[model samples]
Target: MKTVAFYRIGMIICTSSILLLLISSLIYNLLPDNDIPQMLLLRDDNGRIIGDAPFAPSWQFPFGTDREGYDIGYKLLEGAVYTIGAAIIISLLSFIVAFGIGIIGGFSKFRVKSFAHKFFTSFYFIPQSIIAYNILYPVIWEPMEGFTTTLSERIVIEVLVLAIITVPTTAILISNETEQILGEEFITSATVLGGSPLFIFYKHVLPHLKMRLFIIYPKIVIQMLLIIAHLGFFTLYFGGTDVCYTPFCHPPKPFIQEWSGMMGTSYKELGLSWWIFMGPLLCFTVTTLLLNGIVKCIEGLIDHEPYKSKQTSRENETHSFESHSKQEKFLFIKN
Candidate 1:
């Protein structure tokens, strides 16, 4: 009961937060202009940049100003859209690839599964950050084409990178789960009854696999988000354009307004204003918590054994009652 209550609380919080984020993303994407908040613009005497420009946080500006005089709040909100969007794209792509490969490998003949396992083994040890960095090299060296592309292209890049990074681990995990299920008595009986391998695997095995995958989805999303955050901290993200003062871009610009990008830019300016760093840091922390909460919720949802057992017990009671009724009627008829 305690565990179930905890999960319920977590689910409510995570769902609310994610919904807020999605709404904010929709608003930001729809907005025509991406101007720095008026409060963050350079101020003239009397806290005005030229004549009427404002300075610092007030009702007009909630998060104050950055070193560049940009509204920290606006930027932070915009950043959330990119970070969340990227994470979603990556998570979905990774799941699709991992699910396909895992199912195939899990149900394959022994020889095929062995070869697939060996193929994935080499990638199992690669560090995610290193893999993300290596993947970024092409984007960095090529003409900056990612920025001019549509929103879908930007999402595609994130998804591809995340899928590549996450596939091996997810594949291994799902394959292991499937392998265990394949060893069950029902699976053996199905095989003995001349059930086709594919049909048995799909009809019998995948029902259980679906529940396991739901439980795993949140974990995979968290891992992919972490990887993207690390890459963003290094300024290797896509869709962001940085003004170049140097002949060549030194620290690569972030692709979009991202939590890591905000952190990358503002962590050093912590002395300027705690709000600058605190806002993004808080966001990152909360997002991590949200992901963990979501995982717990998913686990709770899939943990049907408790419910199933109760259901079975009820059915047994009903069956026993009916049996007793029939016996009483038989005795009455005999009398």
Candidate 2:
């Protein structure tokens, strides 16, 4: 199949998965909370009671049951909104901060631009996962003593930290793009005509950046998802982890039922009930792949004409600068 065909196929699959998750969440919310049926309850052959038993995939429970006897399928459905929604929110916030800093720095005087470039360049080298984890650890990690934070508070802190960590790198990218746009002859012409900075930016830069934003936004979402997964692997699930003391003191439990948290909380079952880990792992993999596919589609649709024009304009600008320098040198020699 052609590359574009593959992208289209990916887009379809990804879109369908997202839609299914959305529908599932909507249906789940519509049902009265107390009226929700227990679908993953298990009983012994002689009808003895067993709490939270593990089971493999079967006709009745397609995705199987976790160690807690919760249906993997149901958990996935319930957590989809939080998992995907959080990533989208973080990505959008990142985009806003990035564009704001980037546009301002790109158009600002030399000192501001230089400082922004250097700062982000240095920050870009540090691993984003590490940064996110450190920032969140202090806020999310429950101490052995002192007051504990509420779920809503932890969620707020996590989302804000995740969003903030992305700002520097994203802003650098926007700054570079903005600088290139500023170098174009049209931008210079607009400035020469007494166009205010805001007017010129709105008229010239934003239109060019809109398509670029479409391409970059999905990538930011994917990055956030990966970071969340990375944090999950470390048992630092979003919304923080809860302490459990039943059947011996177990590891902290995830407060949110999102896929990453589910995977983190259920990781202990990897040996006993592999299905639990696999279920959320599969969801994370498929969701990220779908996002990646969408990105490829957008990339394929990107118009190269603007890039070509930008390149040409940059070369013209360089030549003009050189010519102006030569004239200055000739005048100095004549004097």
Candidate 3:
């Protein structure tokens, strides 16, 4: 087998993720957070959708503007903040729920484990974005009197929905892993030695499972972010809201900048201003790739023997072949 060095691979992936993270941070820091809505509404002399004046890429406006006079550069940065932030929050929440449920359910009494299994299985089957829109809509979003509604409640709903969806999966993953660990020889030995279940789990199992947890973590985050992006594609907003703020109500949407929302807003003009689409698209792609790389690295590191053993086998084969050649020469000389 072609063996890969897990440590080296992890280092490369970590470096890449860091680079993307830095770029995302820089993109967010340079842009004005408050004036984002107004920037998107920028127009030209003819009332066209041109972001800032002159529509040029400069130190001030690195991304240029759009047909609607919106500053593409600033918009991209703001969108990055939203999408990336949302993904992170969603991922973190999901992981927690997943870990909590999975660990408890997996290790719980039979009745509790059974209930958890059925409940999360149902949740796992349901599309998270749909749940985000359907189950939590009424509880989260509040309709406004006059113009478009705000996003506060809806964002909450979105997070809740995402958390729910993630919890089930996370629980399943963690539980399965925990179960396997609990069945291991060391775990069994500790239990036989009068170690408390909790103590063994926390001290022995959890410590050993750290690498596996790392492998699963990025995947969970990636899954949630993908769902968020899909919702953005549908142009689903909190209730009747358009953007984060409507100059009246402040919805939970303002709490985080969503790349999906930015992409949704500019979806129609994607052909005209590819940058509008490209900016968010690129950000999502890079983030996804980075997360994926991290997961692979973790898995590689944890399961180093898979590839390393192959290299060893090949070396052994070569050594054996050399030994056989030397034996033949010695036999011929003796003959």
Candidate 4:
């Protein structure tokens, strides 16, 4: 009960946070103009550029401002959609690839399954971040001729690359689960009864796969988030990286203002204004916790075998009683 309650609480908090982000994203996008100020030109009586300098946390700006005077809070709000949306898209795409491969491969002959297992296993040892960065670099890196890729194109490519990288691991997991399900007596009985493989799969396998997907989907999202963050730490931001060649090669900046990129870009300023990086870091940490909470909720919903067993037992008892009562009534009426 305690465990169940914890999961419930976590679900509420996480769901709320996710919903809040979605709403904020919606509102931010709906606004006519939501651009971050590259330089908020404010001056004192002495005619100094006060706004360009970083400021500590204050009542006016709760989260503080960065070196360029961009509001950390506002940037977080703007970037929330990109960060969360990218993770979601990557997770869904990965799941789609995994589901197709896992189901087909799991149901395939032993030789096919063995081949696939070996193929995917070979890539599993490689780090996901490295794979993602390598896959994304060519597409995201700006060439000397100037910007060729649009934001949408870069984002789409990044999502696809991220999704593709996870397919092997996710497919392996799904294949294992499907194999276990195939070994069940019902599946064997269906096969013996002359049910076609497709028929049996549709009737008996898809439902189980759906339930498994519910539990695994959030985990995939979390994994993608970690990978994105890792890539950001290496200065490979989502969308693309913009490099300035003038004046001793400035650090590459993210095309879009994402939370991970925010942390990466502002990491150098931690000594002067810790809040710049801390705001996004806190956002990432909280979002991760909330996602973990969601995972726990999913586990709680699907993992309670004892409760399911008890419910099934009670249902069987009720059906038996109903049948017995009907028979007794029929006998009495005949008499």
lDDT: which candidate is best? 4
Candidate 3: tens digits of C-alpha lDDT, residues 46-112:
9997544434455656666655556665666655655666667777887877777777766777866
lDDT score for candidate 4 against the true structure: 0.81
Winner by lDDT between candidate 4 and candidate 2? 4
lDDT of each: 0.70, 0.78, 0.63, 0.81
Ranked candidates, highest TM-score first: 4, 2, 1, 3
Give the TM-scores of the predictions, in the order they appear: 0.76, 0.80, 0.69, 0.83
All candidates in order of lDDT, best leading: 4, 2, 1, 3
| Candidate 4: residue 106 lDDT (0-100) | 81
Ranking 2 against 3 by TM-score, winner = 2
Top model number, TM-score: 4
- Residue 307, model 3: Cα distance from true site in angstroms: 15
| Clash totals for all candidate models | 8, 2, 21, 0
Task: For candidate 2, give the lDDT of residue 116.
Answer: 60
Colliding residue pairs in candidate 4: none
Candidate 2 residue lDDT tens string, 10-113: 66777787778877876785677723234445677988666446778888678888765667788888888888889989899989998898898888777667
Give the runs in model 1 whose Cα sits over 4 Å from its true position: 1-6, 40-62, 122-124, 141-155, 240-252, 303-335
lDDT of 1 by residue, 1-335 (tens): 77777777778889789879868866986889866554334455786556222234557567766666677777778877777776777788888888888877777777767776877777767778788777765553234433455545655665676687888889888988988988887667566655677766655677667767877887887787777667766765555435355576555455567777777766666675677777778777888788887877868865623534334434543554565456653334554
